[model samples]
Target: MKRLTLIAAAVAAAAAMHAPLAPAADKPVSIGKLERVATFDGAMPTGVTVTETGRIFVNFPRWGDDVPYTVAELRDGKAVPYPDAAVNVADPADPAKGFISVQSVVADGRGRVWILDTAAPEFKAPRRGGAKLVAVDLASNRIVKTVVFPAEVVLPSTYVNDMRFDFRAGAEGVAYVTDSSLSGPGAIIVLDLATGKAVRRLNGHPATMPEPGFAAAIDGKPLPATFKVASDGIALSPDGDTLYFCALSSRRLYSVPTRLLRDPNVTEAELARAVRDLGVKGASDGLESDAAGAVYAGDYEHNAIRKLARGSTTWRTIARGENLSWPDTLSVGPDGYLYVIANQLHRQAGFNDGRDLRRKPYELLRVKVNAQPAPTN
Candidate 1:
């Protein structure tokens, strides 16, 4: 416990020393204008979600960030810890009881907000009680359920990236998540929400791994360093029949039936055969599906958001420009708008020759669209 305290203290000190200054003027990277919803002046925000009632929530992972809260609700232009600050500050030794390190938050159609706690900051091994899925009652702002991923399911190398719920499946529903581990095999995890039983499907499958010979390039040049992001973005089809996904470091999109993914009797080879290569959808960081069967993908390398309509042969650019430095996540709001977060992930020191090139006021922008997210089912 003392050793962990020292490390946290050291990190806090380092973040204070490099507190973000006023944003530096730089060339804009927008195709069409994005209406600003909120701004993160202190820390860089990676994931964003908006409820049907327009409640906004965002997360700041503990990756070299001095985040006061891991998950928060943005209200009145400021972030307040959702539910309460106490749960957000759960004892590191007993994280399952509280939020440890939250990577994503989604307000499910069932009127509840789900929090995905990576628990293992800096991609470190997840301690007991830290790596779990927490569901909060939006009406009460109270935690109602906590589902911890057992060590066997959340391997030491597992980095739970993103998830989507399919209410059409099972008694309560089922959740599909991407295990985008940087140092271990990439795969997909299926959790039976009603029973709290989870299993790894397509573990180390090719569909979940980074493409061979993949290279993340920007401005016609290879990024300064290798950015091998495995299956990072995932979305379920409107009918709850298909699940679309792509690796951050790869350009192609893939899909498979949700029924096939949830069946425990399905063999590995059979599951592999069911996987369909949906062809190239650009190098995307997040995937979101609308009720019209159109999938939105944030093409990070191109600073654009493209859409693949149902039965479409190729991707069509919906928005693009210098205003989107590195589009990180996509969410379709209830008001028929698509929201995105441009956190300048590629401009970070790791990809910029070891120099922090991120600008202040990392953006939370949205564009009006003619679609709503697929129903929870």
Candidate 2:
């Protein structure tokens, strides 16, 4: 017994010597400091964009919330009806005349803020003249243009999720939109800013459609198999040559040449052949690009922000924390900060068996990205 005890002590000592002397303190890996810019206690905000002069704008979709105004400018922590309250009034009779179920607001960095009106509340079909893009001139705070999508382009099941602009494309530039339809196959809608003509590309393509049998897991709980969103997050390259996009239910990122997308002559088959799968980026909601050519994505599954540097194929986490619950949208501002919305979308009543697990005060968070907003022109 004495010999056995000695042997055991020697083995224990050897193990202790090999182990970390102090069980190295658990250090959380974070690349940037996340700063809370604002909080939404009333209605949840889905999209956020900052102008070159630092004007912050956010949109609240009519998703079962008592949204007094669909679009608002965040000023002094208050949600003020943007441009005025008259335009925000949802007139079911004249849905195209005002903001109805606005889904995203994007500043073109060229003194224009574009509001994308999905006009499909509760994921319902859009009314005639409801689905459109309204561009407001920032300097004048006046509606400069309203392009109502045709019935064919904005399909009955189409949910215009997000869009990015490239002013260098056509005479007045072009806009690329993602149709993240939950009920139907997804596709990309390209709008010619000059003629207000919209064309659908990659319609029901495999890349745009959600991955079969793939469901998102939030907070260690896998979402229901029925929960699938396709072709949601989108970003434009700095040189205006490539457009990168990903589906909400997929981790794979894909890019296609903007030249082909802008060309009406390109056939669907030819365009699909040009799409290059950029491999897995975490399940992302919103994607943004900087003037430095790096693309940033809100990695909702990891509660983090990731970046794919120019000429690099791998994604690196830039910011991560528990507070980043459901990073829903990403916008790179002119102030060299990447703004994100943590709206806890997975906890919504629809996904949580009608329990609405979301807590109050959804967050508008930003992290210093050391990069400026991509040039719109």
Candidate 3:
């Protein structure tokens, strides 16, 4: 406990060395009822992750925040501004703006929270001093590091949506992320943390490219699948050998050997050659593989969570549609449960051509993985 305290103190001190933060909001928070956890409205909660200390982190990307639901650290039950104190980095007069338009959140090995901020709204040109990854020390719920991406690594139209860490890669921890930019073809952006270097691979490959001429059919007619071109969700297998990914609007799921992705020496063509088509499409918006090797997919088309059996194309809906909004990101939390966000994204005004269809408060839900959970009988 003493060691933990020391580490926490060190991280807190580091965050404090940073700049002055914006003032906190002064509104009466409505935490709603518990037992059956109520929802909170996020303009678009694209990613969801939980910390070991049980604090939940959820984000709102480019979408405009009518209510201040940007990046929030859920403490007790209130989604409050984090750090509790403003940080003054180089100068108070040149203080950084508060966290806003965050795309995804993940808990790393050291108990710190990592946030991927798209920075720019709607995958626009990278903004000045924006488009970076921020980490918060769990012990004090404070910001510790802000790693920015170079212009070369992020295309003008790039959208760094979701990311996963592979600590054993590149002599230091490496991060694999999906561009998921709707602008057409997207690239897999790999980050070398030790040196803050990044590279893009498979930018225009057929695999990374959006599904050609694909149209999302939901209300009896063809609709744009959120993004213009489609590529969105990604996941790493439990054993960390294969990287599973799917286009949000396509009917195919694919896996490529992680060896090729982590191998900087490998050519994009070589990486593409390593991809193996996995034949299970759960209408997945987000995909995740739990410790048990079960892939939990949130099927927005069916409004449920589906599981793909190991070593098989067989897929089954594990959790059916139950008041779920448009399910977005998926994560296997430290508590061993499958967590997902139902943001009602597809039903949003942009998808509906400027009419807000979201009724339920965007919610973060947990489904108890049925015990002895053999991938569906």
Backbone clashes per model, in order? 11, 0, 8
What does candidate 3's lDDT look like per residue over 287-346, in tens digits?
Answer: 777666677676565556667767656665555444554578876656556677877776
Q: State the lDDT of candidate 2 residue by residue for 331-366, as single tens digits.
A: 988888999999998889988888999998999999
Candidate maximizing TM-score: 2
Candidate 1 lDDT: 0.81
Instruction: State every prediction's TM-score relative to the real structure.
Output: 0.90, 0.91, 0.81
Question: Which residue pairs overlap in candidate 2's backbone?
Answer: none
Could you tell me which residue pairs clash in candidate 3?
18-88, 18-89, 19-87, 19-88, 19-89, 20-87, 20-88, 326-344
Which regions of candidate 2 fall more than 4 Å away from where they truly are? Answer: 1-31
* Every candidate's lDDT: 0.81, 0.87, 0.65
Q: How high a TM-score does candidate 3 get? A: 0.81
Which candidate, 1 or 3, has the higher lDDT? 1
By TM-score: ranked, best first: 2, 1, 3
Give residue 281's lDDT in candidate 1 (0 to 100): 76
Candidate 3 regions exceeding 4 Å error are 1-36, 67-69, 84-100, 219-221, 225-227, 370-377
Give candidate 3's error at residue 257 in angstroms: 1.6
Error of 3 at 74 (Å): 1.8
The candidate with the higher lDDT, 1 or 2, is 2
After superposition on all CA atoms, how large is the RMSD of candidate 3? 14.4
Instruction: Tell me each candidate's RMSD, in Å, in order.
Output: 12.1, 7.3, 14.4
